[model samples]
Each structure stands twice: as structure tokens, then as C-alpha cells.
Target chain A: MAEPTPELIQRAQRGDPESLGALIVGQQQYIYSIAMSVLRQPEDAADLTQEACMKLLRVIGQYNGESRFTTWLYRLVVNLGRDELRRRGRRVPEMPPMSDDDGEVIDPLQSLADDDRWADPAAVATNTELQGEIRQALDSLEDHYRLALTLYYFEDLRYNDIAEILDVPLNTVKSYIRRGKERLATILASSESEKIQPPRTVAKSDVPVSQPRLARFAWALGRR
Target chain B: MEHCKEYRTNLALRPDGDTAELSQHAATCPECAKAAKRAAAFDTVVQSAVMPMVPDDLTARLLALVPGLAQPMVRSKRWLRQRRAFFAISALLSVIGVAVLIYGLYILGSYVGVSEIWHTQ
Candidate 1:
């Protein structure tokens, strides 16, 4: 749960394998989650996590330590994910329509009356199929918004850190979260008459593939 | 109600329990009250779905693959892995050898008038 330390990163750059492994293990979940949010595919997320870590391994010496390691690392990760999206012909950050009054841009989700299901505990909790609905809602969002949402709730990152990682204005990141959440509410709050029909969660036959990894990670760090 | 919209946006950004302003605003304004609930529900759904349960081998697997870590592994861990493999093969061969020897002895006993050797122990 601890952020990668400056000393740990320095040790890794000095070519200590244990330290290197520790650094990647520290952020493995975060990297995978970020990739999953962008790619929306678990296998792809895993692959990206591995790829990003290796990329860092080689390039780590060049890391001038100018920024928090994560901000720099995540920038590399987001770019890789975005590039893959572009290669796949899936446009990232497909911006929603912006409404303006005589010149100033306004929050798009501002106009709609709040949906009923937004607050309905039963609908959210009881809809055994709601996970699919949630994933679909995430899919509908632009890449930037999805990235912000994932970092906010999944990584538990502060908004300012997210802005720095995404290399965007702080206000833009804030707007992205606001709009993304609103869009999700709209999607999840489908009228009872017209339900959303989307793909269900993929069934993973094998799971918790790495309980030992977390343990070993701790073990390796203690070896310092 | 219109000014309450700003409060609703702020309400949505933070988690449900942290902001007292959300409770107060939602109490006075029907819209924010509903927005708060929906936002909470959204948070619940996203958190559950987005969280990753990763493979435990991730770090080990990467360490194995990394160029710097590629230097011959810690001698003891390698020895342990090799020792395990060696024992497994030895046990398998021992079982097979014992079965074959027993069958051969039984065949020889029948031909050499030593049939009693096949009984008792």
C-alpha cells in the first residue's frame, strides 16, 4: 500500500534485482488496473502490466526523479494504452458535446434531471446483472474520462495526481470525473421498460493467480 | 433548486459519507438527494468491478524475465527447485522398478519350482 520510495527506486536504478522486482510488485495492481480501465480486457491488462514494467526496467536510469515516480510511470502507461487504442481504431477521449452560453463551456451532464435509479439501493444491489451494466457504462465513456474514473476509485489517487499523470489541466480532469459519473448514472438508470443488454463478465476459471507474489514482494522488500 | 445543482456536483465527486453538505443539500433539494444516492450506487458498482485481483507470480515472473535479474538465480532457491524435481523423478522410477521386479520374481518362481516364494510375504 506504500508508494514506491525514492531510495527504493534509486536502488532499482542501480541494478538491484530485488529492488527492481519490489518496485514493479508495489505498483503491479495499479498498472494492471489502469491498463484494464483503458483496454477493458483482463488479459490485455495483464500483458500491459508486464510490458510497462519491463519498459521501466530499461528506461529507469533515465528517470531524472523530477516527478513522483508514478506520475512519470503512469504517463508512459497511459500513452501505451492510448496508442494501442489508436492502433485498434478505437478512438480514445471521444469528447462529448460541449454546451456553451454565449461563449463559456458548460458541464454537459448539468442539464438532465437526476435519474431515479441513481439513489435506488435495491436496483443497484439486487440487479445481479448490474456488473455488466456498469462495465458497459464505463465502455461508453471517453478514454480520458475512463482513465480519471479508474485512477480516482481504483487507484485511490488524488485528483491533482491524476491531472499530473494525464498531463491535462486540473479543471479538465475534474470535469472528466463529473461528466463520466453523470454518464454512468444515465446509463445505469435505464427506464424499467428499456433495459440495457450488454455482454456479461468473462468467467475466469482460475483466479487469485498471485497470492504468493504479494507475499514474496514483501519478503523481497524486507531483504533491503 | 438551480443553485442546488452545484451542490449536487460537489456531492457526486466525494464519497457518500464524507460530506455533510451532501446530506444537508439533499435534504432541502429533492434532486441532490436522489443524485447522492445514485452517485453512491455508482461508486459501489465501479469500485467492485474495476478492482483487479492479480496473479501472485507477477513479480516473480517479471524478475525471471528481466535482464538484470536474469543472472543465475540464488543458488539455494535453484537447488531447492532442482532438488524437488530430482526427488519426484526418483520416486516415480523407484515405484516402477519395484513393480517390475516383483512381477519378474513371480515368473521365475513358477518356472524354477520355487512357487512357494510367491505366497506368504
Candidate 2:
């Protein structure tokens, strides 16, 4: 497919209906997958995807094409995800005032570090108990780290491209990956208790590699 | 040996060349090797997460979004144009306001000047 050219961008920026329509067509699945990956709710993902696209149309001129168009779109989807998380936080029951002069309760999820908390980090990691902890850990990660790790490992972006998209230095991008991975490893370790076996290694070098089911579910979710 | 260490770190994160050193490391240095193995497993898991058969309606749905996307863009352009026009009209009014204020001040100053001259006479 042709890259989103200057002309296409100009037309879209001007509100050319066809251009706007084409832009949405080109990016809908990507935006939806991004929302699904972060939010883990199909209905919410679909809603965010549409909302992100509409926002993109309204502010298309803000796109300077300095980075790939998709990167900016990813940023939009991520912001929406963050907003959704904050909204959910409000809906969650807060501990009622213990006393008349009671202070605000701190978010327990925010206080704990990533590892030693949740065992599995993948959103679809099957164990329900582990999944809850993992989601909390994921939500706690600073936005850039979460965005970078998701786009890199989950979305399969290279470290360099992520740097470009996030407008951070390459080393910074690496730091986010390393930190995110380490945090995930920690969470998995604490939750699983069993020394998590790497996907079963084949001693016989010739055996085909086995894929983990949780990973498969995540991948399917992304494509959907 | 130096290259091997660097290679091991990368492989520990995502397996690299020569499973032999990594395997040996796993056998002896349990932590390093286990990490390497886990990294490999994680890569497979993430890769699995990344690739899925493209969905059935994704192509059509995406195409459908384009028109929806364009409608607002057009509306926004018109909105922007209106905004600019409003600003321009306001600017013209502002200039007219300043001119009127200056004219009134000049008339008042002339009356004061004439009265002073008559008082001196």
C-alpha cells in the first residue's frame, strides 16, 4: 500500500470526505487492536477505536507527518486507554471513610512495584488470579513505559521505531523495554511461585517449538 | 569470550546464535540459562500475540470508517474559516474604536485650548 502521502494528508486535513473515509479505513484495525491490547474489553476497544478515529479526523491538521501517521494514531489510542483506566478507577469502590477526619485512601495498586506482584504480564495470561494482578501491574506502569512495552513486544515494533514514535532517545526506549520486561518477570515470579519454566525447551534441538496458549490469545485479540 | 558474553545477554532476552553456550549456561549457571530460555519462550509468546489471521471484516470496516472520518474534517475546516473571519471583523472594529476615542479626545483638547486663549485675552 502507498504510504500516507503529503497530498493524502493535506486532503484529509482539509476535511475531504473521501480522504477522511480512506484514512479511517486504513487505520481502524490498528487502532482497534491497540485499544483491545490495552483495555482488554472488546466492546470498549471498539468504542475507543471509533472515538480515536473521530478525534484523529478533527485534529488531523495537528499531524505534521514528522513520524509515521500510524504512530500518532497509536498515541491517540493509548491516551484513550489511559482515560478509560482513570474512568474505571473512579467507578471502583473506595474504602469508606474510617473516621470523620479520615484522609483519602491511597491506591493500593499504585503503591506496589510491578514484579513480586503479578505473575503473568500478558493481558490474556490464562490464570484468573494471576491475570488480575498482571493487569494491575500493567496499569501501574508509567504511561510511556506501558505504551513503549506494548507497542514493542505486543505490537512487534522495533526498539528504534518505538523511540521515533515516542519522541524519546533510543536508549530511553531500551530502558523502557528492559524495565517493563524486568517488572513483568518479577510479577510472574511472585505470582507463579514455581520457577516459571521458559516455554518448555526441547532438549533435542530438532523438536518444533511449542507456543504458549496465553500468547496465542493475546495475538488473536490484537488481530480482532 | 567477550563477544560470547554480549551475545548471551541478547539471547537471554531473545535467543541468539549457538544454543550450545546458552544450554550449557542453563545447565551450570541455572539463573542465566533459565532467563535465556524464558526470554525465548516470551519471544514466541509475544510473536504469537502479534500475528493473527487478519480478521474477516477488518478490511471492510476500516474502509467504512474513512467516510465517517471525513465528515468532521470538512465541518472543522468551515469552523476554522468562520473563526478567522470573526477575528478579522473584531480587529476592524477595534481599529474603529480607537479612532473614535482619539477624535473625541482631540475635540475636547481643542475646546480647552480655545478657552485658555480667551482667558489670557
RMSD of each: 16.6, 24.2
The DockQ value obtained for model 1 is 0.22
The C-alpha local distance difference test score for the whole of candidate 2 amounts to: 0.56
Error of 1 at A56 (Å): 1.0
Clashes of each: 7, 10
lDDT, candidate 1, A138-222, per-residue tens? 7776676777888778444676777888777666776777676666656655532254454233334322456544444443344
- Against the true structure, what is model 2's DockQ? 0.07
Writing each residue's lDDT as its tens digit, candidate 2 over A105-168 gives: 2111221233332222343244445444555555554555455565665444556566665567
What is the C-alpha local distance difference test score of candidate 1? 0.68
Listed in order, the DockQ scores are 0.22, 0.07
Residue pairs with clashing backbones, model 1: A118-B38, A119-B37, A119-B38, A209-B55, A209-B56, A210-B55, A210-B56
User: Model 2: chain B TM-score vs. truth?
Assistant: 0.34
Model 2: runs farther than 4 Å from truth? A1-19, A86-145, A154-161, A164-169, A189-224, B11-40, B50-65, B68-121
Cα deviation at B99, candidate 1, in Å, is 21
